[model samples]
Target: MTKKNWNINLKEMVKVGVHFGHETKKWNPKMAPYIFKERQNSHIINLTYTARFLSEACDFVFDGAKRGKQFMIVGTKHQTADAAKLAALAARCHYVNKKWLAGMLTNWFTTEARLEKLKNLMKKKNTGGFDQFTKKEAAILRRELNKLQEDLGGIRYMKKLPDIVIILDQKGEYTAIRECRTLGIPTICLVDTDCDPDLVDIPIPANDDGRGPIRLILKKLILAIRTGRAL
Candidate 1:
């Protein structure tokens, strides 16, 4: 995109409360009444810097996905924020379940090992090995093993480093960030007001703590990716 085009889009995004930064807070009260107005709408309005960061991060993910690069969408919890779901829909990306494999990013080797065990157990059960185990033991083992297998299957979808790691909850995803850093991969995250922005390569400051902002931001990013791809 041309510089002028980018600048125009950025301006428009800012007008819509996309990237309101700390500097904007310095504006005279009369000129910045919208800040307070936005605050009343959501708790994140007070976190202008974070909102700006998230807007840029959203752009980054959209751009990268349009180029056909692989992106991984990970979140703190499953079926909660809708960030992962939006990202997957936009980029056709892989969604990593946030439970059982806590350190899937930082400790991939260990995660892989656990996944192998789960796969083996699944295979054994599939072949009618349930008769060999006591009923209670079989039930417990099956439940735990199935959860692990689901996570493993998600991880297996992206065998190598992704072009970008989009994390919904920074605190909940500490291990994912550590692993991304270790592998020299870039990250895009919705950083809460209290979070350290330096942890992510592309930090979008917002109320990473809430569901509304997360859903809104993620939906925009997915739309951007889909639109860009159509072009």
Candidate 2:
């Protein structure tokens, strides 16, 4: 891949185990079309379509970046948490690495209040207001800060709803997808054979639980976003 152009071939994709899908029994009926065939009782995804869909999704993300659209990345799974944070940070977008707070985007006003409280707690701690208070008061502030950080640390700067959402595990994070659909936010997701591809605007059929593939795909998205920054 060149600096100005980024593309991965079949060999690289195969080396990353992108073609592997869920077992035939666990496969979703809607994903039948994307399945090339059943091999060893498991569905083999059509890498041809995976590449095509990935390219299209990259175009969408890149264009969104050029237009200065905000995107939120959701990846709370063990396999994808680090990749999600890295990708979102690289793209300068919000991420949900821990918990996808309910109504985070759809009902942001109420959510903002919670975020504000978290901010106030941090301010009190930084200002040493707890110094004059009792130990109980100091302990309360500490507990609140830790809880809020675990809940909303990755999304502290999400001042408003995102224009698009990029997710790692569609099936595992279906609630995130559902909220996006309800709010009319377009989504791009990695859909395993068990997931419904129709849930996302762009679905890349790949192993959503693998580190290598998730890393590669997220890298591609980061590259696309960075490239758009130049425009």
Candidate 3:
């Protein structure tokens, strides 16, 4: 895939409000290099840097995908959850948008066990295995299935830890990032001015709270992953 074609211009980024950052008072000092200026008590991210980092991240994803590496997209925040799920689905990648269960990565054995249980429950439901149970028992089992579906639906089939993780909000998904870090998995994050870039492998400084910008970034990343898969 050609990197040039996937590059988004600064004008388009500005239109989507990607340049907007957290309030100046809340800004992280480590992010000074990515901050263009302070406007109206909020930091304005440097779109030029955003484009550069994003391109680098896309290239990395493309190469990894070509090598059959797996990825997991995470965004538990309300504004970013839907977009993350859609993007991951588009690229046929694993995702966790509803909630980031602690030890989802660090405790691989337990997590995999839970995923197995989820698969079994789903299979039983689809095969009408619940018909053998009484009404109350069936209802109780159905409730368990629903809960597992909500919590582990996206990752029900993920057999192993992902090679890389794309996080929409650095602050909101700190626990997930930490798990990745502990497990030696690389991370690509959409970090706002208030977030520390050191926490991620590739930090694409942007407005993590804006749905438009999140969707736009995720769209490009998905395209890169899809292209790699095609190879």
Candidate 4:
């Protein structure tokens, strides 16, 4: 394995509140190893450990991408959704920012069917295929197409289950994590102090709720992925 230098900056992470974790009362005991100290009733994530773990995760993602492994970025929460989509787009990876359908990965056949439907609807609408229908019918079709696009747009091009999944919120995306686990897919997740670190294959302990932290972390990961793909 080659040595890779990471772009994760410890001082920058602290400035963006990435060191901040959930309140002490809400913290999971499993997160003790990553907690630096308690300040103002909240846990402070140990930046040293955060940086180390994040670098390892980035390295893994980069190497995987270099080998043409597919990734799915999952973050449906309001704070992280947009960031997730943008990062995935930048990295050319699949994403699920709007919602996580229960059988998204475990039920590949159904998900593929929905994706095929979405593709057909989009193609028809783009090439004037909708002109054959009456105005009212076209309107109905357009609405359904829009709904499908909003729900499955990110993964429409994904022909199979992803080799890896990057989850933004461990607690909010518990179902997604479980689905990945059930399918034996590896997961790299941003876990707050209140989240179970053991649930993910690679847990990056940080503030999962803040937009700054979320964007910062995703940005780094995307850069690594892009670098890998470019190579």
Q: On residues 1-231, what C-alpha lDDT tens digit does candidate 2 reach at each position?
A: 123335957778899999999899999999988899999999999998888888888888888888898888899999999999988888888899887777777787988887888888878888987788789988887898899978888878778888989999997888899899998999999999999998889999999989999998888888888788778
Query: Cα RMSD (Å) per model?
Result: 6.4, 2.5, 1.4, 1.0
lDDT of 3 by residue, 74-177 (tens): 99989998998889888999999999999999999998888888888888889999999999999999999899889999998798999999999998899999
CA lDDT of each candidate?
A: 0.62, 0.87, 0.92, 0.92
- Score residue 157 of candidate 4 by CA lDDT: 89
Residues 1-231 of candidate 1: C-alpha lDDT, one tens digit per residue: 211112224343444454332343433342232233444333224444444555566567556756877777787475343567556855677667555355676676786677677777878888988779999989988998777766665555566557777788777878778888888888887654445667878766554545555666676666656655666
**TM-score ranking of the models:** 4, 3, 2, 1
Better model by TM-score, 2 or 3? 3
The reply for model 1, stretches above 4 Å from the true place, is 1-55, 77-90, 100-103, 116-141, 150-156, 228-231
Q: Where is model 3 poorest over a 10-residue stretch in terms of lDDT?
A: 1-10
Off by over 4 Å in 2: 1-5
Please state the error at residue 156 of candidate 2 in Å: 0.3
The local lDDT score (0 to 100) that residue 76 gets in candidate 4 is 97
Clashes, model 2 = 0
Off by over 4 Å in 4: none
How high is each candidate's TM-score? 0.65, 0.94, 0.97, 0.97
Between prediction 1 and prediction 2, the one with superior TM-score is 2
lDDT of 2 at 107: 82
